[model samples]
Target: MSRIGKKPVDVPSGVTATVNGQDVNVKGPKGELAFRVHDEVVVEFKDGKVSVQPRTESKGARSKWGMSRTMVSNLVEGVTKGFEKKLEISGVGYRAAVQGKELVLALGYSHDVKYPIPEGIEIKCAKPTEILISGIDKQRVGQVAAEIREFRGPEPYKGKGVKYANEFIFRKEGKKK
Candidate 1:
């Protein structure tokens, strides 16, 4: 009964998808990714499209059906187009840089913070205050971005810190004179 689960995910040209048991694997120009469908859901590749359906009419099965389908869709899209996250640092001395496999950050800390980049993920610093994170796995890309932002989340008073490119920070008025 899930509308999203009813629509099968399309397998675009030049991208290949395979369903083996509960495992769904997809490979495309960008990269390859795999996902294990929940046991309550059934996944199948048919006619150049991947389909997901609930294994039973149980409430739990239905609840996971749509989510499983979306997960599969994300895998296909990830391998084909990949995913990216952009972070911007704002402050007098806040900056970021990538050297070798590590990201060096200066968030007004007493010492520079060094974060080791994970495999299969790429980090780039076009500008000292801009950080670009890209990878085939959507979850990992987001996790990295979040971790970086966690180092110095924007403060309401000064609105200075690392934050997402499109994020809006709520400003707080200073003490009245």
Candidate 2:
């Protein structure tokens, strides 16, 4: 038996979780999220806690049993508290601004890079060099943050580029003359 799979997921107030066949729908104040659970995993709600049970002892079932439960638990937490990602601009003259529904990034490129903001995600600029991305879905929030960071990864020499707030870029010394 998987320890994580045997654990119960607590459902907070104002969040409704419904299991429909293989799909789990979670609705909360922030938004609604749906997940397609693995075939071998079965979820049940009892005494205000959700539990995941595997149908068999096969490798595939064991592998996905805990994962499925964690995914569902994350979904519930996301809708309740949401998710957030922070980015920092390092290069000089590098800045980001919101224009309508798009994010305009001037990262030393000839032309500005315009990124369309997806629905259910919110972007905020705190200070000229800091950016905050928040959403209910963890995958979507991470994808947006990665796409933004990919615009200009941290350079080795100056470490000037877009990077996560907590990310560290190792610096190397130049060759001896």
Best by lDDT: 1
Reference-based TM-score of each model: 0.97, 0.96
- The segments of candidate 2 whose C-alpha lies over 4 angstroms from its true place after superposition are none
User: Candidate 2's residue-wise lDDT over 1-177, tens digit each?
Assistant: 789998878989899988877898899999899999989988877677778889899999999999999999999999899999999998889999988999999999999999999998999886768889999999999999999999998888899999998999998887899
**Clashing pairs in model 2?**
none
Instruction: State how far residue 150 of model 2 sits from its true place (Å).
Output: 0.6
CA lDDT, every model vs. true structure: 0.95, 0.91
Number of clashing pairs, model 1? 0
> What TM-score does prediction 2 earn?
0.96
Worst 10 residues of 2 by lDDT: 42-51
lDDT of 1: 0.95
**How much is the lDDT of residue 26 in candidate 2?**
90
- Which 10 successive residues of model 1 have the least lDDT summed? 73-82
